[model samples]
Target: MTNAADRIAVSTWSLHRMMGTTYPHNLDTLEVGPVTEAYGPVNESLLDIPSAIANHGINRLEIVSFHIPTRDKVYLGELKSALAAVDVTLQTLLIDAGDISDPLTSDRDTRWIASWIETANELGAERARVIAGKQKPTRDALDLSVKKLTELADGNAGSAVRLTTENWFDLLAEPGHVNFILDKLDGRVGLNGDFGNWGGPTKYADLRAIFGRAETCHAKASFVDGTLDEADYAACIEAAEAAGYKGPYTLIFDANAPHEWDGIAAEKAFIEARIG
Candidate 1:
């Protein structure tokens, strides 16, 4: 059996600083066009990240869609090969853009999101996580999201790359909305519970509600004055355990100023101490 320390995973989001660059190529006119933004002349190549992460003793990774500079098959194949070389598993390919809840543009966004499933397959990822919606919570909006999400799941029927949605953005800001929509989907789509997405005194209780169905997790810990909020982090972990969640805890570390790899290592050490 895999030890608890072995269950730790990393999300490329934690290394955004080291990456120092991002790609904005996707559908959805919610903001801007696919114009390339300048951040890095990249410090490290995406293909090299697998080994970098492996060096830290993490064998699983969730990649943000934008972090992947291209959908080119050759490049995708090279990334897959890099992961194979290090024996790192691509836990999930996170499709961070698009709002399938918008009635006007959802049709276009749905097609755009579906296209990435092929890309995930190319990278040999275990799942492709999509944003359920960006619209405000309402019966019509939730139902529309469910329809689109179900369509994506059905459209990819029998795909080895499973489909997942997160408790994020306006549509799922609350547990009621999350459970409602996932229930509506009726197992068509799975959950990727994110610790930092929802906040408040009720965060722990809310986590318990949705994480029970979570196939993966985004274990984002809060920091203040450059210190980990161990209370919050511990409670979040306890909540997930209470919900009976058994999945990789993908660490997410975004700081005001970064020593991203250091922040990640700190979080990893905390988790390993508790569950190792």
Candidate 2:
């Protein structure tokens, strides 16, 4: 059985902008402050996420590297050190590799992606979150993405990092498309399920279809009138659990408000109640 503590993790992306008194790039320079004051000044570029975890009572963290500039090994090392100093471990690294529909794939983009995978492994990330981006529905483009992802996964085969793509746009967003990609790639690639990004009505069913292939998940809660739609939220979690997912429920609260944190806490409570 999965312990409740092991099954819940908060995304630093949710509070990327707030954590310390000053936006220090290294852990030694960070000035720990009250949670309320740290809510809006923490720069994602900096590595103060450990301080966020410490003050927020959250143990697991999903760090988004897209917010950080790419291919800077020195900066990546500093960030990793900061997290280590705070005793906060990374669960996954979320990245926007590039546009899947780009006709001629850019070598520069591919190099950056390879470097991103290296950095995630160095930071001790168990999985890397990638998105297929906007799709133009071309056979060549889809084939190129699959090839690139497979190569990426192979490159990191010996490491703890696994490459997982999220369903977005019209290509990988459909259940059929997800199955196709996963089956074609086999174990070389996996899914990063985002509950809010499904573009259809059967959100729960769609999630269930891809759950078997999922390596990580994002609990993206879109609020209505200061409260999440309880039914939708519950259904998503239920489908994930029913599919035998026993991983941390990573939360991504993108709403803009001081009470957004409150909403996140409430959502966490709701998920915990159901899981427990």
Candidate 3:
């Protein structure tokens, strides 16, 4: 039988600061410079993450594309073996930073996403998460996103890895705009609902409008002075359930906790207590 906790996964991004020293969030496009070279020859091993999460009883992972130190097949194979050793499911490979909204850059962005899809396949990941766009949400941008995303999906036909996007960046700031693109793509792409991505008075209402379409969730909790806001966390869960969302709640622990695992454990417990 699958335990309720089994349905939960932890994203490597939750440990971004902990995994290694600071570098650009978009490590994929780093230019030749001190910041770039300092990040070169990754000091941290991606291999350690899977087993670390398994130690906390979480058996799934969503790896950020930038965190992948090397794209060499051998290194990926070793990472895949590490996950299997700990029985961790590589749920999604998050490909951050790109703008398919511009016609000038759409082709390059599409090809970049395709490359991650290939890497996701190599790592046995079930899906890859790409940023919708950093550009302002306009009709033209939406159309371009649809075109590039469709091309990416069509290009990777028959691959086991699927594609997903989050309610993130400028273009996806509003739920209506998010729905517009998802509606156009139909089911060609998936949504990875995130709690902290959108906030303010209408956050829950916005989430309610789209949670049902979520294939997975980045269950991020807000923290103030290193303490979590339970009221907001509970409401986020309520909103998702009311919207009929029934998908894995990947605990996203981004806080100033002394230990990353503590934040993860608390978030996981909070979600399980509310949902289960």
Q: How many clashes in each structure?
A: 0, 2, 0
In model 1, what are the clashing residue pairs, if there are any? none
Best by TM-score: 1
lDDT (Cα, tens digit) per residue for candidate 1, span 33-54: 3425455556777888999999
lDDT of each: 0.87, 0.70, 0.83
Candidate topping lDDT: 1
How many clashing residue pairs are found in candidate 2?
2
- In the order shown, what is each candidate's alpha-carbon RMSD? 2.2, 6.1, 2.9
lDDT of 3 by residue, 53-105 (tens): 88888888998876776778888999999999989999999887678887777
Give candidate 2's whole-model lDDT. 0.70
Error of 3 at 153 (Å): 0.2
Q: Give the distance in Å from residue 160's predicted Cα in candidate 2 to where it truly belongs.
A: 2.2
Model 1, global lDDT: 0.87
TM-scores vs. true structure, each candidate: 0.94, 0.83, 0.91
Worst 10 residues of 3 by lDDT: 31-40
